[model samples]
Target: MSDATRLVAISPLHSPKSPHLPYNRFLFSSFRFVSNFSNCLKIKHTWSLKPLNQQGSIPISSVDSSSPVSIDLKPILNEPQFDRLIHQAQQLHESLVVLWMANWCRKCIYLKPKLEKLAANYHPRVKFYCIDVNNVPYQLVVRAGVTKMPTIQLWKDGNKQAEVVGGHKAYLVANEVREMIDHEDQP
Candidate 1:
């Protein structure tokens, strides 16, 4: 469905008041606050679940894969942390999907959530991270050969294996990311 025709609901508690919450959602909201913020006013009451015995968060593995769960892609800043993350992922033998983007990039804001949904599909096994090109050292972005606003790269064996430059529409970029992940799975 086209974006303008699509309907979405945003709750106040779904509120991202904290910096710890997903920054991408914050960016999207900030960008279109005038249009979508009205949706928030329509919310008369906050949503709550029927008294459940559970309290803490559930691990993604325990959830059924049939249902798609979209989680925020964790942010990695600075070169040391970036190198350490790659090292950690390599040690664990996990693939890394890194979205090299900046907060100012509107395209990045649109693409981040879609990538997060994609991240959920491969959760734990293939971890996802977002490194802001503007935040990290310029050398890092240059070394990664990133020359675009929203560049999604798949890292395997401590190296970049595939990249999807998110210059097109969000959905198309998402599909290409999925295909990239699927294709990289084979020998």
Candidate 2:
């Protein structure tokens, strides 16, 4: 026989009753190893992926949780509260950040907490309030010129100073908000 034929004859894959047959122990063991390795990779990938909202996933801003710098943002429940807060901020010469949002808006939900956290840095200087456009009257929303779901407006002396239309990603919106706060002294 030729060298090629001799090699094929000695190979278990080419044999009718070889130990490496398709349904034999050796083939089964190889398949089991591959399957187990694939499952292990899947498990390892799952463990490595961390969720954004999970505890310890986000770093705390400061070591002291009870510091005066911590800001507690509350939603404006009604038109009366909205009017009152605006008037109060104007009287106190403090800046007011009014977030025009809708409950059904996914972007609004994600951006709200981030804005609240951002408000902490300007605590006592700026106050943040969330207003669900769905819950509030149509006239109030119209007055604010909120044509979008997550429109963030900086109000001072009962007038709109700077507005951020959150039609983009959360991070970009947050950056724009920070820029607005940073340049708040500009006309």
Candidate 3:
């Protein structure tokens, strides 16, 4: 499936009325497993249950529990309760790197786990975060001028340092980020 299609499949599009129930019902009822021409599975599966906040939406929580190696990409990205991501972004350190992505972006999903692993490896050094451009504030998006699906930015002392505009290879990006961190650690 195309990235856009995959993104749509995984992302729960906003519904004005009965947001949770409708989607839940659709999943338990209308949602069907269809084999594509290439025999690929067309349905998206979300087994983990997320916390529901007072706004009738779910809050994204990090998968930092028992499964340290496993990536909870959804919780890391989506947080309807918070207005700005700077708080979570700041959790890493005074310096941080934010990944601005869209749910329907295939490259984002493919690269998420790798990025998570990199964060796990470099924790407390390079703060890593993922923000869904579709759901985040428009002002920040405009400030960042993010026109692509998977844009990455490095911040130092809460200021913008550098950024990668599009989705690149995970290893390459990780190396670059590591280099940036190492450079900052220098005298």
Candidate 4:
């Protein structure tokens, strides 16, 4: 051994009341959370975890519900757009399903998605569009002779061939709209 080295002896087993213990759990205990409301000592550690997903309000889309076809409507923002689209469909020798809807109308809102799905069945052959009645000029609405909230019209060759006023249940309205489309299609 080097001169600097010091010999150490192993201590015997610690007695129950040993002055030098390895650890004191009480000395390193966690602090209790304090509440802002009062200075009273809380018996339990009061803690909470906020839910990751909260339940509230009407959902924009249905859960676990999906459309196989995933069809959508092309919106006509103005009268000029409406005229151009109708003319285009006429020139191409194809039909257009125009849904005349208003934001405030609950029936219009309900029937729209059903019609969109209906559009999927006629995909590529007949195009589908939506015109918010409020967005277009009143004069154009008068010219089209639309007097109701939800009007589903089938147009071909720059003319409205068939129409269904959808003021009833969505399913019935969808059926009427479908029948109109099918009826207009036949020679």
Candidate 5:
């Protein structure tokens, strides 16, 4: 078994804890401290769980990857606010691409930049967005049949167009999206 699995077996989160290791004690203390701080600050500080790519937040799409083209996967716009985005895209007759990602997923981490670059370069024509899978409801994921992180789904005129799963080369996704846009323009 893997070292991680063995350690997990020894200290299962679902089971009763042992006082032998300092890990649990540290965790409990940290949790308690955070909880107390959160409660105290709850009234004074208003916390919004927006995505990482907000105005002042770190840009998720500027991350370095092993690929040639660097992408920026930051939420160039705002929160999920899908309906508003859909309305805008429909009004402009532009195709929209939504990226579903998780903060902890390594593949998603790697693909973020590429996605962002696509959004930047393709802006005003092919609209792009990044949605944290953690923030979005499970029903949305299940309804969209999103079985993997770093998934990209395309939409046009409020209708589902296509979807790409897993991390893909930036150029390939851009090409596919451009084709979709072109195909859409044909009479």
Candidate 6:
């Protein structure tokens, strides 16, 4: 057989015996030799380029720092801010949407920005807040009955009225949240 063919055939045998110390040492040395040999060879390549359109212009940051920017849409991060938001919503009779999330959760990270954009539509009518499960007190999370990350709950009169466990796609979760808000009056 050719050298390459023999190498391919030996791969399966080597993998099965990888737990053996002697076999592992041999495999490590062989891999290092192959890697070093491969690194000695080099290839040349060329790239095609396109020029920029000089007529196109970019906008500069003209925003005033002194003026209070639009209602800071960032999610509430602390207990005091959370309590104050809930109290204000209760007093105003507005619906409150709290997103129970965790920093390490990929789904939660992706879902958060989408939810924030959605909040803009219901501005002044619905309030949105985010709680990182890792940052907050354990008792608070326990009280909410949050067994999973990215749990979206709608609160009315300081009570949880509806919940959307975001285990599915972002679009589906957004649709569910919208439906929940639309059908808030129903049981």
Cα lDDT computed for each candidate against the true fold? 0.72, 0.68, 0.56, 0.71, 0.57, 0.65
Model 1 regions more than 4 Å off: 1-14, 17-68
TM-score of each: 0.68, 0.64, 0.50, 0.63, 0.51, 0.59
Off by over 4 Å in 3: 1-93, 185-187
Clashing pairs in 5: 61-72, 61-73, 71-113, 71-114, 72-113, 72-116, 72-117, 73-116
Supply candidate 6's per-residue lDDT for 88: 79
lDDT of 5 by residue, 1-187 (tens): 2211111111212222334422111111111112234334222222121123323233434443232222334453333567677878889888888888888988777676556655655655677778887877776677667888777888888877777776566557656655655576554
Candidate 1 residue lDDT tens string, 14-68: 5443555432221111111223353542322222221111222333333333333
- Provide the clash count, candidate 5: 8
Q: How many clashes in each candidate?
A: 0, 0, 1, 0, 8, 0
Candidate 3 lDDT? 0.56
Best by lDDT: 1
Please give, for residues 96-174, the per-residue lDDT of candidate 6 as tens digits.
Answer: 8889999899999888756865776577688878888888787788887899978999988878899999998987897
Model 6: runs farther than 4 Å from truth? 1-73
Candidate order (lDDT): 1, 4, 2, 6, 5, 3
**Model 1 whole-model lDDT (C-alpha atoms):** 0.72
Off by over 4 Å in 4: 1-68
**CA shift of 128, model 6, Å:** 0.9
Model 2 CA deviation exceeding 4 Å by range: 1-65, 68-72
The most accurate candidate by TM-score is: 1
Off by over 4 Å in 5: 1-80, 167-187
Alpha carbon lDDT at 174, candidate 5: 53
With a 3 Å backbone cut-off (N, CA, C), the pairs that clash in candidate 3 are 7-104
